[model samples]
Target: MDSSSPDETAPAADQTDRLILEVARTELGLGANGGADGDLVVLDDATGALTRAALDALEGTQHRVVVQETSVQHALALAEEHRGALGEGRLLIAGLEDAPADLATLLAGRSVHLALARLPKALAALEVRASSLARAGVPALIAGGRVKHMTRSQNEVLAEVYDEVHATRGLGKSRALVARTARDDLRELPPRSSEVEIAVRGMRTAVTLSGIGSVFGGASADAGSLLLLDALDQAISAGEIEDTTRSDGADGESDGAPEEARAATPGEGSPAVLSARSVIDLGSGNGLLAAYLRSALPAARLLATDDDLDAVASTRATLESLAADAATSDGAVGTEESVGVDAGGRPGEARVLWEASLAGQAADSADLVLLNPPFHDGAAIDATLVQGLLDAVARVLRPGGQLWFVHNSHLRYRHELESRIGSVQQRARDRRFTVLQATRS
Candidate 1:
């Protein structure tokens, strides 16, 4: 019901993708004749196109297949494909908004065929399916297309976790990797993943951040964040931003820090600005932005939120590591009141949700929000995800609050920026990216 990201550039594929899909589909009880009764197939990162063939092959009267995908658009499209089945409850299509939870609840004590796409993402999906369905004595049929999505080494990494892992006959350019999972193995296998270090600096000194549980193109020091960082640092140094520690009617110290952080009453023509006391990193992927924001505005409260649990975990780890480093390195640690750790051992509060929007955050009084809205919603390119993020900004940002945003240069979010919040201005731009600032009027 909310929005999502990107245009998945459809690769020129041979019979490989279709053949692999067919193998996975059939393996999941989508027989040449019809699917078995009470069979549900979970297609992680599924597009509409992939589920269509399986639906077509199913005998409407004899078989039932409940197909689930992660994207709303994909789910709607699949629903249309089997309108009759949907009407009869013989076939069901829905979005995996809550992901593994939704699928797990649906798959309880049921045989499942999980068609996974996209390499590392599939691993996360596999973890969910295997753990949830293992105890029911249900056989899982997992088929992966696009061998390039995962390397043989990556395949082997997962094989160690499952009872048995195997490969299907190579189909043109695509090959299927299937792993049989057991309840015991599923409960015991530790996650296999890698880590990366990211360094982001604006006008201020560089801050090195760490990221674990790779997701979202794998974490790195994003150039877009750096672009916004430049603007943010400029805002901080030049006294253009409101003081993070000041309060209404309370006099502020007027020396050393930027003039904006100084105590002052708004002039008649000047904007009635609010000091940023609460900040949320909407769509805080990898938590790098949150970490940088925490460093840049030490007085403000920071909250990093993401839809992916991995991203939240990664972000929390990065922030904790950064905080730990700061505490020991001849530095003043941020006030524990403003920078407390979360349940996951994340240094600052990190909340995970199923959507990009920051609804019900900050008690509806967030003073600042930063976002790099994802363009890819699942496997395909979509812009509505950005819109959803913007909506969150409008809903959570108090009047006179600000939104710092970065996007692909061609995304051309200026118009939407103006429409959503007044006084949109370009802060920075490069060949591939653009950074903008909008204040909620």
Candidate 2:
């Protein structure tokens, strides 16, 4: 639902965003799409609100704006704010996760005034996305906060695709970059480096994770995930898993699938005779847990989901590399094949979804779910996302499912987890992180 009327931005518009608009307005002499039947496209995946705020600044003009988002929370917020423009076709939305392949097709030959807000994901992903925008033949793109947000690597990547990429002086902590793109060589991008691969182990199996700078804790597996993985393995091996699978959460299958069919039979099972029959990695960054799960429980079907574009792409890359590694190693052959890598780089046969929140996950589905809920929003330790994820976990988990959650030690999530999930217990804890296990009632 649109939050704002035809001519207004949402009431929650902050000062920093409005500041960005002022800079854009001053530098670009902002106006409606000037070309015949042209509409400006706001390519924002970083903050998600930049497009809305920019549109708000340009609201009274004759410009038509299209907002494409992979994050569901942001799309809904902007859509709600601009309900009138959406109904009249003056504004539109596209989901990057839903149709990543269609990005080029959507932007082809478009006379777009693109606003690339400071990317919240990795620079490698930013490069890929920027190249896509350049390939679409956008005439001009005004990047928000280029001075403060962009690193030298980021600037170089942007400069490679966009001609005359120049920056403005800082506007109180905010800055801008206006680029008149020279987009003929979009397919000619330089290769990304693979120098910073981090190695982590769950029990005896060691996996290499290569992540970009924007990923939490870089490419390395954090201590929390490692500890939780061990505890989960022990629980599954002991048959402590709850059996409340309603439906396949990743596919939105009806809540009527038989639980016995997906479970591991006691002594009757043959070559694939194991427990933890199904698993999901919530916010599976670099797919560390998924890889670990595949190594530990080879027969389990794995599904990895994330809201961040970089995390999704990086996780796919990580899993694919793991699959290739498994094929070469003496032991990982079955593990690799069982994980089921699709051609599009997803972990399973299901569509690699980019959900804004965990709201619509399959209810009562899964034997085990592993998560390390992120609490930091910028510099602040925000618990709102953690709360939301916990709620989603309760709704999606089956009667016998297990939730392995690792979070900051200081957070009061134990009570909340116990309330939503059935039984909560501390598995491990250190100064910075804590490992928790909660079984669904």
**1-441 per-residue lDDT for model 1 (tens digits):** 101211244223245446656665556545544444445464543454444444554555444455544433445445554555567655655333222324445555555444434334445545544444454444544556665665676556555455677777777566777766653644532333334333333334444454434445444667787777777777765555544343333333323534333223354676445466567787776666887777766556576766554555456656666667677442222221111123121223333332335533543467688998788866788987788778778877766678999999977798898888667878889998999988777
Off by over 4 Å in 2: 1-4, 7-9, 12-39, 45-66, 82-92, 96-98, 101-126, 146-157, 169-173, 183-213, 234-277, 323-351, 410-412, 430-432
Q: TM per model? A: 0.58, 0.70
TM match of model 2 to true structure: 0.70
For residues 272-303, write the lDDT of model 2, one tens digit per residue.
22234457777877677767666555445566
Give the Å shift of residue 373 in candidate 2. 0.4
RMSD of each: 9.4, 7.3
